[model samples]
Target: MDVDVFVAAHRQEWDRLAQLLRRGRRLSGAETDELVSLYQRTATHLSQLQSWAPDPAVVNRLTTLVARARSVVVGTRRATWRDALHYFTAGFPAACYRTRAWWVPTALVFILATAGIGAWIAGSPEVQASIGAPDELREMTRPGGGYESYYSSSPAAAFSFQVWTNNMVVAGISLTLGVFLGIPVLWVLLQNAMNVGTGVGLMAAADRLDVFLGLILPHGLLELTAVFIAAGVGLRLGWTVIDPGRLTRGAALAREGRAALGMVIGLTLILLISGLIEGLVTPSSLPTWARIGIGVAVETAFLAYVLILGRRAVRAGETGDVTAGDREDELPVAA
Candidate 1:
């Protein structure tokens, strides 16, 4: 067999081994030794066969050998929970940092602006008069009257369900609205911001500012942040279509596609968790001080993660990753 053919066949076998290693599995020492021995033997034979043109039978045998190696790998494999999460989280930094400059700030700005405007209107008499009553939003705005009923009626489960339902609704709206890209997402954000701002402003105007703050701040902080993050991801995706860089639109999009998954997945987790937190804790009997402290911590942590930590992670990946002939670094072979 020609050395080149043998080398190529053997290289395929090596790749199979690498993939198995990465997949990971429990193996006895002797089993491992035997596999290694088989690997070395295959290597030697390929090396010997490479220089000379081998007959068809030899080529057939090499193909069979490679197939067998792959089978052994597949048979030995076991999926670990740890590896799945590792892949998911490993991709998070690259995903978030790459698009943060656009989405993060934009999301925050949208939330802040809408909330601010609604709050202002709530505070303004003429504007409030112009708008008339708070609309349906006002009915939902009351904590003790409407919100507390969920808890008062069914202390154990209703609050949790309410929090989950509300948070999920917000997240779903944010995520689905992302389809419209920046503008659609922006609209959804404004709607919620206004709802939140007006609701709170009305409460404060009614002289229940402390109570309103205490009721909403706890879970709203996390839920709102998660929605903003999701919006940011969608905005980034749309922006890619609108403003592709040096690369052709298609090429840049393809590149971004791989990174986009992480952001979406991460956002999914955030919403689910935030929903749970909102349903269970937002309507709780927690004190004002506790609520404020929790809100501050939630906001601060989110800012640090999305803006600071996320940035560092992406920079680290871009600088540290090697692109050249990293063939040997294929998936690790299981020990």
Candidate 2:
């Protein structure tokens, strides 16, 4: 087919389609019908031109035009503030609520493990010796030593940004690694637990457990909660691999994977808040109780947000998954 002859035949139709796209007016029913018809014909014309070697530049222009028209015909979903609003208010919370069975027990196990490790380390002199030299351990655990000094070591603003970046990285990894059947998630949790336990044990042995608690509790409660939620959601994602229930493993993985990604957004913000508390409140001159109270209050509000709002969202059928219109359409399978 002569490219020029083909172009001449369809130039009017292509121009009209381009005109309609540029106009961006509300298409009347008839106009909408015309637009669809024009898009289909133009698509076919481009295909014919491409089958024979058409002018490269013309092919490019047609390619762009076809893509734009396709968007108009298919209807693009532009994200608005309302979408973000819905994500936080409904999607994130519902996801958290639905996965509470996984995360709540996760939180319990982590706490128990942390406490047990702390107690064991505190009770055993041999454990303390294995941790570090006596002088180094004392220097860190002593009141006003490395334990307290670490928080105020850097400027508050810089420190907070650093903490936020670090925690977000950990949470991101925890959520993404869930495809491995949650073993890595468990390792992530265990590493954190051991670190927390070691700190508590060292401080308790030094008779400065109160000071350690004061520094950590201010941010640790919320910070650790965010971590646990990431771990639990990741675990759930990995579990989808093992037991997909009604859905095929791939389908279940896709569903839960999307939800885990959404959880990352929520956890990022949660970790940010905790980072602020660590940088600002924990290191501030506020009394220990006041600092701890702030942490507790913030943590309480977060939990309430997840439980109350999430429960309601779930009840309303929010799955923390993207809306039906937003997600990819699935092909039907033989039952």
Candidate 3:
């Protein structure tokens, strides 16, 4: 089979398909039929050329044209407002619920580590000195000192935006770096836990543990939960690389990666709420109980969203993955 001869034979149909694709939504009913017919014929021609003629340039051109024609013929679904609604109401929560095994343990471990470290540092003068000089530590823990002043130093709105942006970057890093077998995610969580513990220890040594809790709890509960979720998903993704179970490594990563991305978007909103609480309520003059109560309520709502709605969505077959129609068809592989 002469490659030139094959190209001459199919060039007209390929050209016609390109024209139809260019016309796009303006295609007439008859032209639409013609476009489908030409697409099929060109696909057949491409197959024949690959088998018989094997011209690299011809194959490449046909591949691109076929892809373009297929897109036009099949019509891509554009995301709508409803899609966003579905994602939040079902997709995000379902993804979180599915990964409870990973994140729940993560939260518990982080809390315990933080508490233990804080206690050790608070009880030992040597440990406090290792962190900072007595004067510096005193300054940090003193009432109307570094810890309390830090929040009000910046204007509330500016402070909130800064907090939100920083948290977003941290969460983004956790989610994206999961492919590195979650080592980086562990480091990130550990660093965060250490910072919190240090702050608690310093405050406790100053006999200001109550002040510290009052300022931190109103925002820390939900904020830390979101971080745990991100870290847990990251670790889960890394584990998928090690043992993909029923699916191939690539497929497992793709599935978990997509879910991780969805969680990132959801966690962004969650962090925003926490940022607001930190910026507005943490530094406010409200009673400590009231402020902490508000935090508890918000945290409860989020958990209910995951356990109740997330479970329902999962049972109903939502995997927090992209819709089936949106994914490309995969070739079957035998185990």
Candidate 4:
């Protein structure tokens, strides 16, 4: 049958389905599945009929069908852990590649660090002094030394909460700074990066390399990685304003801002998990080798999920498809 003819016949059904979805009526399992199938079918039908000779009745039916095709949803169901994982994987990487902000933060960090190094080598005491820490609270808290003083009081709990809180603050600062477009965000990004590098340099200069590695390596990898991801989101958000494509700056910002929001939320979660590890696991009584192994495993799992499994899952959803239960399947199961 002609696609128009099919649409004309089902026009009323499409409108009614749209109403059911919009109204939040509980759809039987089969009904929900059928709606999903119909949505895909109708979208295709409309695209194919676009060039065909237009009939008023068929056109009217098509417009209404298209509206319903996009509008029908079972509503926001409770997200399972599986769904949250999927959302993070899809949301972050896609946002990264889709915008220039993905590279900007890292590039900016490199540039600033190089400039700082150049200044230091040129015998700028101001630069050297500025790089110097007023206090070595971090250095003083080492495994073999008095480094434990910072968390020694509360022990594991104190370290965990401190790391977690710091991560949260950094992520929030990156996201909020996005409002200034790339400038403010870049400023915050550089500050955080510099702090990390300077802190490590201080530890190294203190001749406490083992203490540094044992203290930071376990969770610093994840914690720092999450910070960069947050920076990426901020940069992307800033790009909309700085570039804005064909749209006005405000309009472009709104568009990109909406897309980047999910990434910020996901980054928050990443920071939280990192903090948990830094506070609890990083300072654990576990052997150095064991801590390294667990840290590597956590980092590996995150990478695999984001880069590999995440993409595969999305591809499967795209081609492999989901049944979601059709109208017939929705028929009540006989008691």
Candidate 5:
């Protein structure tokens, strides 16, 4: 029970463990074995101190040393190429599939709202005037006008980067601000919907609806879907605060927040694809049908990824959260 004597005896071993840890991925086999042995012995020493001597300073030092030594002995897993492969093929798609209920309806509602507003604007001069002056609307809808020129105004590469950055910010906002009851998420989507409606109304009024569809559809399908997914995940996070069901509010938020973050990473990649299409394909000389076809193909592939791979992932019990080993340990609570 003599803390000083015990410390004197184990100090050298503790120092050795620290030295091995400092070596960091460069340990020889013998040093690795020694580190494991030292970790176990140090852990026992910590236990004894807590049980008998309980010197706070010594105990804390040993605690930290043992933890570091343990990590060195066990080693952390590096992300391999295989890990990246599995994430995209399985993890990301599974996450999307699991959230289908949220995002699918989101897409539908947004589409309906946009369609109604667009139709109203196209049909009514008053509605159109409320948006802008007649001359402004005329310029926006002209064959070589604002709506069409906006995409090609910048060089394609710069435009793609700008679009990607902007979309990422919007998605980031939807995910991060969902903690505020999702009001921001709704507002963001509504703002976007209005923009779409205004464009549709303006173009249709000028008999350029064909040009609008051809230009927009080529990238809008995938681009808009990514936005809808971001909004849905954000709203879901907000709802978790209100009704966590069996979980404590904190636990539910953590779970859904992690899933929402995963969506953020996945959506970044998805939005990049859409950005490329918007910059390159949308402004290309290719026929409207070809551009639209490319968009349709990409959108369809994404849907299939979610429906087929995602369903399989869900069936296999994937919840789109971090893998069990990476997740913090959940304490048991009585049901």
Candidate 6:
């Protein structure tokens, strides 16, 4: 953190980058590669000085240099379809896998809470009564009633879009709201659990639990898993603020925030698939087992995608963040 020593060490790389920037984009391939390396090093050094030393003159100069380097490096660069390919195949799943610690537990708790609430409502006449009048509950849970009619209420495509939008809103909130110490994410998740649990309780009370499962399981499995992932990511983001673990708070948040944003895009697509199942499969004349079978198939594939591809990507040094050129390098510190 000694300003003089820090500056002395990295001054050459900064000077070299500045020299390259003045070349007006006429550099050779080797020079271009060096420019990238030096730029990254300078960027990292600048982040450190600004964060740890805070010398106005040095920080400002390096900031300007890094910005100039970024434009030169990124301005002519284009993100191809390959970039998108890597994002889905590696970046997105890797991020999700890394969050397994957070999300796996999140899924478990949600399932437990839902089951527990369902049991309470189903067993306790008081809880069931509080939910709604007995007749209304019976009508809602009755076979071929509100629950079954819901999936067929709209055209399949339109219904899918609507369902996707609604679920995205929920998942988006779960992923983004975790920054507020994750409290809001917990609340959002709790509300979902309660709603599902209420349905289970009502269905069970009406002796139509199978009907409820048949309708929801068609899409609920994947849809809710995506939601759990978002909530888990959010909670982790909030926790990052508390124990950034060697990363400065700003650094940790920046890393996780970017990763969460990527998850938003990934989850958006995932929820769309679930919405399709909800709209098309849930209301289909196909046997209940077939519908549920389709849902289970996709959910299983998704987990495998995360566990197999995501794990491989993570072990291969992917942090689920954007590509190296797109992200900032953390400032290395001495112990």
Highest TM-score: which candidate?
6
CA lDDT, candidate 1, residue 131: 51
Candidate whose lDDT is highest: 6
Full-model lDDT, candidate 4: 0.60
The TM-score between candidate 3 and the true structure equals: 0.83
Q: Tens digit of lDDT per residue, candidate 2, span 190-255?
A: 998999999999999998899999999989999988988898899999899999988767568889
Q: How accurate is candidate 5 locally (lDDT)?
A: 0.86
Please give, for residues 1-335, the per-residue lDDT of candidate 6 as tens digits: 68999888888888888999995459999999999999888878877775778899998898889888888888756889998899999999999999999999999999999999999999999988887887887678777787778889999999999999999999888778899999999999899999999989888888889989999998999999999899999999999999999778877898999999988879998999999999999999999899999999999999999999999999999988877777644556554
Candidate 5: worst-modelled 10 consecutive residues by lDDT:
326-335
Please count the clashing residue pairs in each candidate, in the order shown. Answer: 8, 0, 0, 11, 0, 0
- lDDT of each residue in 132-168, candidate 1, tens digit only: 4655335544555653454445554655666566655
lDDT of all predictions: 0.58, 0.88, 0.88, 0.60, 0.86, 0.89
User: TM-score-based ranking, best first?
Assistant: 6, 3, 2, 5, 1, 4
lDDT of 5 by residue, 199-249 (tens): 898898889999999999988999998898888888888888899988767
Question: How does candidate 1 score on lDDT?
Answer: 0.58
Candidates 1 and 6: which is better by lDDT? 6
Model 3: per-residue lDDT, tens digit, 1-335? 88887778778888878877874359789988998888877777766665556688998898788777778778888889999999999999999999999999999999999998899999999999999988898888998999999878888898988999999988898899988999999999999989999998889889999999988899999999999999999999999999999875766888899889878779999999999999999898899999999999999999999999999999999998888766533434222
Q: Judge candidate 4 at residue 275 and give its lDDT.
A: 73
